[model samples]
Target chain A: MGGDLGPRATVEGTARALQSQSRLSACVFGPRALLAAEVDALPADLRVAAERLTLCDAPRVIDQAMKPSQALRAPRDSSLAMMLASIADGQADAGVSAGNTGALMALARRALGTVAGIPRPAISTAVPTRAGGRCYLLDLGANVEASADRLVDFALMGAVMARRVDGLVAPRVALLNIGVEGTKGSASVREADALLREFAGLDYRGFIEGDGIYSGQVDVVVCDGFVGNAVLKASEGLARMLMERVQATFEAHWSSRLVGLLARPALRRLKRELDPVRYNGASLLGLNGIVVKSHGGADAAGFGCAVGRAMQEVDQALPRHLARELDYWRRANASVACGRGVSGADPRRMDADNPQR
Target chain B: MGGDLGPRATVEGTARALQSQSRLSACVFGPRALLAAEVDALPADLRVAAERLTLCDAPRVIDQAMKPSQALRAPRDSSLAMMLASIADGQADAGVSAGNTGALMALARRALGTVAGIPRPAISTAVPTRAGGRCYLLDLGANVEASADRLVDFALMGAVMARRVDGLVAPRVALLNIGVEGTKGSASVREADALLREFAGLDYRGFIEGDGIYSGQVDVVVCDGFVGNAVLKASEGLARMLMERVQATFEAHWSSRLVGLLARPALRRLKRELDPVRYNGASLLGLNGIVVKSHGGADAAGFGCAVGRAMQEVDQALPRHLARELDYWRRANASVACGRGVSGADPRRMDADNPQR
Candidate 1:
């Protein structure tokens, strides 16, 4: 209902999620007629319990430039807001959307609220690294300018999600910078480094250069939204360009086409390994409830993957564990400005009354 | 001789350059005895002229840290400094080095001086786009924080180099930002957009996102060094990771290994097409003389390619042409600070007697 493709893909993805995992349930939010039509379109065998699909009639709010008050304000019964409200009311375990990113972030912040001790939430994406392993990049465009304390919070939250969601034990985390040296980056990086170094219950691997992200040398990379956005976009652009070139090269000559036929299986395998759909979902971390942002242009299958990923995160209790970790670390480092002890309570704990967690 | 692997690779590359182009003349600069030994290591017919090989016994000021003073303090008798001085003195047409990047930039600025109207120079590298075409990226770690005026200079300089160096006519220029929309991105991008829109000489293509860099939608991409460095490193890391995974996949099973062997030629061709050596040289634009920077880890073959690239730039009179263009653009848009006019002066008209440009 949120993305460019809208409910068609959402419905298809919902069916896939049910088919892929028997225990999984979905609360599809959109116009009741549209949701009903989408569900009706699914294969009979893949259809789930009627109660599993909750319909919330949300008016479409696709663009951010529209007046926030005029565009986002709806009759209290709007679909997008209702879905978030459901999460806040403990009716839904997690929320998933392939809609306008800015709108989604704002909705989640208002309805679900930020996690305890976190000033601002960050969006984290799992990118397939050159090492054939996946690495988590945080603040992927959530907050453009982050303070030292906020970055530390991002690292803590990212580490928890990587471990709980991805099942990585003792995940290696690094601060993304211009160079690997301690003194090489901006003031924020230096301060974050000092804070991260003293934090407990995590494996902090110091500084990582931009090259380290795809090198697969670390499990988690933390940076402000600006740098992370640039890296993610650049990688995506390069991947697209490479695929196009490979196709063009194969079609250049008859001999090359023959070679292409022979290499088709290998090439397809490579393409599958690098498919964006499989890695399309991104977690909006530091929110009270789990919310996964799928690509705006995602198809049904891609949206389905996002749904499955959201379920995984919810079942794993990533937000709770991260909240506890933040509490523990802040308490331990009470002398620091960002420490939980100094604040007398977790900063993210302010949103606990929102009913999401 | 200042890079990790110096005269050994440099001498070998020099020999290859001579063999490749009969009309090319190279003046080797380094410790006379060390260079003589390296030259002697080559076969008689492949050996370079002894008189062309001049030794300037410069003491190493810094081990790996590239300081401006280290380049400046290098003995006049030493190869690195002398080569730069020779270029400025008109004894040599161009200077190429697989040495410290900062040192090269500093020396080039000190000797050759900045181009007319350009405040700061930029290092632009041509990367193989996924579109089977080349795209130039500028400020690849030269100036971390760039002003609006500097960004405009980068666009103009990059466009000129793309046309003259890569042979792209009417090269399309793009300013890299967070999004393709004109209103999106940081304040710097917004300011740069306004500036580029007013410059009529540039074939400005408005805004391009980070993902557009590898898409081959534009001939030249411009950004601050900080963003450019992050993008370049991430791309390199991703490519390496992909190649490694392909190798690991091939080695997974006996049948896969056989498939890999059969597809070896195609893979080799792909590797060659993407090889960094094929595009190893990066020009320090805005300098009076031609200066090319090779990768620190470049081997003999990479070094040779850089030398050839520098020769091409010299042959095309890149600096002079850029200088004239900046002057023309500046005078044309005198009311507005178009290109060089934005920097508040004609940089090309600076005193040659000044030690620092």
Candidate 2:
């Protein structure tokens, strides 16, 4: 009903996730017959836990090519829209999808709305870094353009997520820019930098270059969705290309082939460690409810990871925590200039009533 | 005398480049005493060819922290200004530096103005891709924001570079965007896509996502400087991180340690294949003269690659070839719609007289 692999992968992944999170339950929203068939095919152990599964029939499917406007116009019975609607209606604590990103964002925005002080929800995911640590990068493909205030909001939300989820007391935050220098980047980024510095609660580390994303220097990297999306995909492309080359090189010469055989176990471990599947779940942050976007092309294991991510956010009550923190920031903004040297911020934009300004 | 490592790396790299390209000659611009010492310390063979090297004694250096405007306002006698002046004055065919990018771009643009059809110069360099090929990415950090027509100019310039330097007859060109769908990118990129399609000579391949940059699916990837710079640096950072992880994995356990020793040769070979140093030089394209920007942190061997890159472009007559192709495009535009359905391009902007329109 969702993603490229549709209900088959989704159902299997849910079953896989259930094995680990025993307390978890799901209302599978898709074609009733399809869900029923997949549910029937679940192993005996999972079938015994069938009482936890609810097949919420959603006959219509949103095609990958569907535009956000088109998706919004789609029937309420559509799987993606229905899944989001469940979250809105208080029937579901969280929703996860591997559907079209634009459509998901549009529907999610319409259904869940935003937490106070947040102009829009952003796509955020943890990127593995060189130091064997993780850096949370946001606005992967949500809002293409972000204002300075919006960027500040993203920083706050990201920091909250990192602190709460990643267990960091004061997670270091940085704005993604062309260079680390204050002089580099677009006017919006420069403005964001100023505002981030003023964000009273954030542990703002200023700017981080594209390469610095993986340098493990910061915990959260904020960017407008355009740059964030580009960086994420480009990095994935490079890693895939490099892995292919590594494999090819191992098989190139007979002498090397011998070494490749000896290194096979270690290489497998290395590949697993760097596997994109392990990092599959991308949280649509800043929303009033938790929604994880699994990679559409992901298999069961990858989708399972996405489910696991959602479970963690739900268990930790991510939305409520984010809402409370955002409220605190908004209230604090009236009296104090958040921090020192808050540059380039429009006073009109900083006004609480016009968050999008 | 510039860059992080200063004169020694430059002197050594130049010497290394000179050995490979026997016809190559250079003017070392820096403090006379320091240049003389480094040049004097060159290997015996390179020293024997000292007659070919000219040490231009410029007393001042442009610090890395200097802003572009600051560098521009600096005395014409400074080392950077002197080096670029040499290229402009016909004393040098090309200029190479590992100094400040913004400073270099400003100085390079001032010294060598833009070609007739190009509105501004773009920084382009080859990024190693998966299919054992190189993808030329442009506007690395030149124009933070580019118009639709300017993006078309980048494609033409990039295609010309690929054809002349890489010897590709018709390089497959693509605009870097968030999504492959025509509807996915910013307004500028969409317009560029339309304009690129109209350019009859280009093997225009529409849009490619970030991951596609390393997918080897396209020969040239075009973007505004901001995104391009971020992508380049992010990829470099990611590659470095992955390499480190691979090394650590090999050392994690006793059994893996034994395999690591046996597989050292293959790993070294892998490292060389994906070496960032091998792809060190970035050409300031669209400028009237050749200017290569080497990575500031690069060592002697890495700097040598940048010199080698500059030599290749010089030998291939890159600027001349680019001028001819651009001229061909301009002429063709008058008679034909470059291709079909060119969208969002300002007709006035396409005019040579209104380059900034």
- The best candidate by TM-score is 2
lDDT of 2: 0.83
Candidate 2, residues B161-243: lDDT per residue as tens digits? Answer: 99889999889999989988889878999988877777676799999999888888899999989889888999989888887
The DockQ figures for the candidates are 0.55, 0.72
What TM-score do all the candidates reach, one by one?
0.91, 0.93
lDDT of 1 by residue, A170-263 (tens): 8899998766666456678889999889877779999987889987789999988877888898888777776665656565667767766765
Scanning candidate 2 chain B in windows of ten residues, the lowest lDDT window is: B348-357
**Best candidate (score: lDDT):** 2
- In Å, residue A110's CA in model 2 sits off its true spot by 1.1
Per-residue lDDT tens digits for candidate 2, residues A227-332, read 8999999988888887787777778899879877877888899899999889899998878788999998888788889999998888778877776666666555
Please report, in order, the local distance difference test score of every candidate based on alpha carbons: 0.76, 0.83
